[model samples]
Target: MSPFAMRRRHAFAAGLALPFARTAFAQGDYPSRPVTVVIGFTPAGLTDTMTRIIAGRMGRELGQNLVVENRPGAATSIASAHVAQARADGYTLLMGTASLAINPALQPSLPPRDPRQDLAPVGMAYESPFLLIVRADLPIRDLADFVAHARAHPGRIEMGSSGTGATNHLLIAMLAREAGIQLEHIPYRGAAAALTDLRGGRIAATWATPPDAMPLVGDGTARALAVSSRERMRTLPDVPAAPETLPGVHGTFWQGLFAPPGTPEPVLARLGAALDAATRDPEIVRRAEESGVVMRPGDGGALRAYLASETERWSTLIRAANIRAE
Candidate 1:
């Protein structure tokens, strides 16, 4: 071939490569624009708070802004659905919890695509065990005494939760089923409202987040009966676990991040690494601890497996308890 012809052919090849290279570089950057993290609950809640905090750190790591949007209602199904249908780009993510897994089983009437099927788990942000609390004025001193009193009262005792099919509500319901006791279930707008009534002696007991219950318990406004964890919480070392009394009841609330299904594997990997790093950051750790959230980090594969197991476990419990969401 002539030298001039060869030069022209090479120039043509380079010209064709420019656009492809730009597209490749864009994908490699993963998040060229602001990333949105959607929460299923209202703002100022545990999930919302953690998500915003984690998103901020993730934004720092990725050199892009991470925006958290709260879409609370319909037991998180609304938010989950929004993320599920969003573009598969890593830009959109869901701040999921055990509720993501539990809701499918409890609300069978929910839309077709399941969160487990529509979302790709990225990583876990933090987890906090629930604390069983009663009014400060209640006579029950411990889990044993509470059980005895509930047994004596049967359906007379009442427990409040954020909602009927929430993780907190199911935790108490599971305990009731395992312990062979009946307690009236009262659904509130959120844990804060439920805590208010518990302090006013309107309810017998309610499962609360350690962050929400610890101060009140310490201030003598509420009494801690037990924690809903396999091991006792560090914040309340003296408090026993509910399993200590019921022998087998255990549950905890977890928060994690997920991308819409079909998100590029590389993008997901980058996000997972950012989450793992953020969870280990000293500042993030300090804030989470103050919120009574234990910093438990997991990568994409680990988080996905954990979500799956939680879904199955909650499904069995919800079925056994005959609990359904309207």
Candidate 2:
């Protein structure tokens, strides 16, 4: 080979390699500035509160602020779409809830039509089951009594939920199917409104998160009948798990961290590590336990698998029950 030909070949190879090297270097320097985590619910709700708690810890690990912003609407589709369409630079993320999986099956027209394809799973944040509570004044004493009462009334016991197609609402439908009872469903704008009606005795029952229900249960305004998880929670040891009464009836409200699709592998790893660390933090675990939430620290692959399973589970139930978004 001539000297001139060898020189040309080396120069061309370097030119092609330069761009690839630069891209890798850029991805390595992730989160050069503050990162924003968008929440799909209003501030002070269980999702918002848990996101803030975990974000604060993650910020310390990343050495950058994880600014949380609320964009509550369309059953969380607005926030999901915003983050899904944002730049995949690890700077903007979504603290997606179980609604992420439920909405796609429940409402096919929503902005984020396919979560697995639109967003990159960063990691699993936390999971907690819903609490089945009824008005304290009701004669219902436990899950058995509640089932018998509903069977007796048959679509007369008004059950309130955050909204139609919400996780808690789906649990209500699942309970009715599994227990072979019919209950009237009353949808509200949010859990707080449903809880308010339950407190006033306008609604017979509703499913609530521990954080939201504890205040009323503690004061004797409402009585907790059962938990929707597969097993009893360590914090709420006395509440019977729903599966004991009706086999195969279990559901949970879960949160997972996500980035826009096509995010760099290095960036996803960095973010996932921060999330795993945050969930395992001593204080975070303690607070989660106190609130009856279970911390599920896992990597992007784990989140992807979990999301797929949840989507399948909810989709089957939604279709079988003919659940439509409100």
- Best-fitting candidate, measured by lDDT? 2
- Report clashes for each candidate as comma-separated counts: 0, 0
TM-scores of the models, in the order given: 0.88, 0.90
Give one digit per residue, the lDDT tens place, for model 2 in 1-326: 33323433454465456677447635566677999999988898777888999999999988899999999888899999898777666889999989888987899788678787778899999998889999889898899999999988899999999889988899989998888899899999888899999888899999998988989999999899899988999899999999988887899999999987756667888899899999999999999888879998988999999999999999999998898876
**Global Cα RMSD, each model:** 9.0, 7.7
* Candidate lDDT values, in order: 0.81, 0.87
Candidate 1 overall lDDT versus native:
0.81
Total clashes for model 2: 0
Q: Name the 10 consecutive residues with the lowest summed lDDT in model 2.
A: 1-10
Kindly list the per-residue Cα lDDT of model 1 for residues 1-326, writing each as its tens digit.
43323433454465456665436544676778999998888788778888888888988999999999988777777887788767666888988877787877887656323666667789888888999988777788998888888899989889999888887999888878888889899999778899888878788789999888887888898889899988887767899988888877788888888887666567788898899989999999989878888888899888888888888899998888888775
* TM-score, prediction 2: 0.90
